[model samples]
Target: MNIVCIAWGSLLWKPGPLKLASGWHPGGPLLPLEFARDSDDSEELALVLCPGAPLIPTYWAYVDAPDLDAARAMLAAREKIHPGHPEWIGSFPAVDGAAVQPEIAAWLRARGFDAVVWTALPPKIAGTEGRMPSPAEAVDFLAGLEGETREAARYYVRRTPAHIDTRYRRLIEARLGWRPLHEAAVTRMA
Candidate 1:
């Protein structure tokens, strides 16, 4: 089965254990994304798909898996998601022959991929498991981070792919001055 893994954030640069058969290619899909999830330990307001977030560009790569199940397992492991939370790891052509998300399914069919997998983690804010954070709240949360945690959060926001621009990103940049990594680097050198 020809399988592909899609990503918009850390997975693009830090694809720790997800075995990939090819480098990430741009133009994967445009999905609603926002930096709303307060990660478990890092406390970084990580990005996740939010219902009303702006549609942003994503990247995709062929996974080195033999089938859909293997691809899901590989992605789940890489994402550190527990097996019980299978919903966090989305798959196309799920057992019922329907894609997890209709939009993604159309993209998969157009690309000729037998299946696709991606991190489908939902937005969580301030210890609220499914709450989405507003742009101001997201900014305030980052601004409140201290020392190493602040640095880590800044790193995460800046490291996100530049093309994946969203409403929250603009707010973060304006409020926290955490621009994209390349922009920051160029500014530092200037």
Candidate 2:
């Protein structure tokens, strides 16, 4: 099966164990994304799909898996998602005839991919799971981070793909001056 992995954040730059058959390409589906998830252990306000967040362009690459199940397993391993929480790793056509994100599903079909997979971790903040912080709250959370944690948070926001601009990104840039780093700078830092 022709499978692809969708990404909007860390996966674009640091894919870790997720093997891709091709380099990331722009013009992936536009999804509602926001920096609402408080990353586990890192304290970075990681990006995740938010119901009412602004639609932003994401990136995609063909996965090197042989089938949908293998694709999902590879993505889950890359994202550190335990097998118990399969929902955290979203998949299209999860079951035959099952409904998934219609828009993304359509996009996938248009691109001739048999299936797509992405990280689907929920919004989290201040130890409260499923809680989505406002743009101001997200900025405050980043500002509150200190030392290495603060640097990591800054790096995440700045290294995010330039095309994946979102509401919180603008607020973070205006307030905390964490603008997206240019591609050359990002490559040099890598």
Candidate 2 per-residue C-alpha lDDT over 1-190 given as tens digits, one digit per residue, 9 for 90 to 100: 8888888888877888888888888778988898899888855889998887778887788888888888888888988887777888888877433336655888898898888998888998888888988777888999999999999999999988777688888899999999888663222121
lDDT of 2 at 139: 88
Residue 14's lDDT within candidate 1 is 74
Model 2 lDDT, residue 68, Cα? 85
Off by over 4 Å in 2: 95-99, 184-190
lDDT of 1 by residue, 41-93 (tens): 75588888887667887778899998988888888899899766888888887
Enumerate residue pairs that collide in model 1: none
